[model samples]
Target: MENPPNPDPREALASAHRTFATEIEALRALDARLDDSFGRAVEMILGCRGRVVVTGIGKSGHIAKKIAATLASTGTPAFFMHGAEAIHGDLGMLTAQDIVLGISYSGAANELLTVLSVAKRMGTRLIAITGHPNSDLARNADLHLDAHVAHEACPLNLAPTASTTAALVLGDAIAVACLESRGFSREDFARSHPGGALGRKLLTRVRDIMRTGAALPVVRADTPIADALAEMSAKGMGMTIVVDDARRPVGIFTDGDLRRLIARHGDIRPLTVAAGMTHGPKSVAPGALAIEAAALMDSGRLSQMLVVDDGGLLLGALHMHDLLAAKVI
Candidate 1:
């Protein structure tokens, strides 16, 4: 096989410009066509007690999958069903309480029509997203969203380019509208996506990942400098919490403080932690968001912090590395 020759820069630029212009005009047309039907589509999905079933064939199917994902992540339960598979037992997934979102540019795809028919027979509501307003699927549907495009981005206007983009944007519009109506929140999204980094930012709390109880490195204010150093070494967090007789954190001695102390006094075994520790360091409650902790550490240019209670009682210790381990950084 041989590689193709390079394209003429002038021709390439012209082609790119035409494609973008066509798609932009198609989008403008779609916006102008938006009407009460859009509101009805949103209401249909909002009123659905069961999951939103998204079905389509070809390029629309790809868009349908994305729509289903957006709907599911943003609090509306949704799933994608391939149009071809609907009659081959996938239709069993539909229920009377569910709502069907059918995507087809022509609004007359046989595969999608069959799926919509089964949905109607099962007492499910049908919402059609199509370029043709009067196609079979649109006429049969309970609600119709016209995704009509002036022309495809392809020069011949035969490909599913502009129409697909319009469909995708329309799907996003519907999803976002439903999200706002349902009061979809960050916590709700985090709960649905617990394994992602954004989920860690929202769902993970100081108590969930902070080193607590025996895992915390602690030393008394009266403890010898050498003993405090030992606590830091044993814990491997590069710092030790200095507590009063009541077990409340009075100060924190970090590796940086130790360096400064050694510069002042080479042999500090005789010194107590109170003489070297930084007093009243910044701290967080157990319920604080992990991202807030990260921000506190970042703003103060710190690596470690004491987790304290309302009474300043030492509850746990957290380090920058802990945030890294929790994927909060």
Candidate 2:
């Protein structure tokens, strides 16, 4: 009996490395080709009153969808259209105020050419991203962006490897340029992504999640420990907010503190909330994002925080669990 010889792992690793290096070199060459036409394409998209209609066929269509999503998420409204479908009936989705972005490696995709003609008839501005600037699609476009690469990353040199990567990068460049021209802020991005965790972090303020008014388990500094405990139990927040006579948060008393108080043989009826409370518990402004409050609670190892207004008046209270349920953390 005998064991088989092991394959050379080094050869496999070297082959992958070489492919990546070649593709990266292709991207570098594409970067060097960026010029005034790229700037003009961005300016045209920026001035578009309607959505940026991105159309391509096959592999380019997949890339166009991603590019359209990036553009929409970053404050530039955009959507992907299949070049073949545009000729069927989807061309009606476009308007004269819109800008059309056509993607083709050969700049001669028949489907794209058909839609390009419809776009022209509708008086829409056309921007072409292709490797061959002299090709039909590019020559007919109002602005032509040359995304030529020296060679494909594929050993066959026939697949849409380097060319697709170049197109994706060029689309990203256009999106970022439009974003800058429109002065799209982080707040603007947050507004468009309100259902995601990032939106919760940037847009969900403390007041939006805090338990306010009668829902807050609050006790005055002079309130007896037994009364405070009753309020905490009734509110089911595991803690009670301690406030001064002026309704400003002064301290906090939690269930853990109650255990310590009992261990000390304290008289619960005579002890005041101030006597058993941890002074100056972490607090946040009502206008602060809930995520910021969650960070403060996590970093400080606290379970809850009091929410206050500008003048230090108690607005409400927030718990770590509330943030978890809201997916704000």
Clashing pairs in 1: none
Residue lDDT tens for model 2, 210-259: 99988999888888888898999999899998888899888899988888
Looking at model 2, report the run of 10 residues with the lowest lDDT sum: 265-274
> TM per model?
0.93, 0.86
lDDT of 1 by residue, 89-193 (tens): 999999999999999999989999998888878899999999998999999999999999888998788989999999999999999999999999889989999
Residue pairs with colliding backbones in model 2 are none
Q: After superposition, how far is residue 119 of candidate 1 from its true place, in Å?
A: 1.6
Alpha carbon lDDT of each predicted model: 0.91, 0.88
The predictions' CA RMSDs to the true structure, in order, are 1.9, 3.8
- Pick by TM-score: which candidate is best? 1
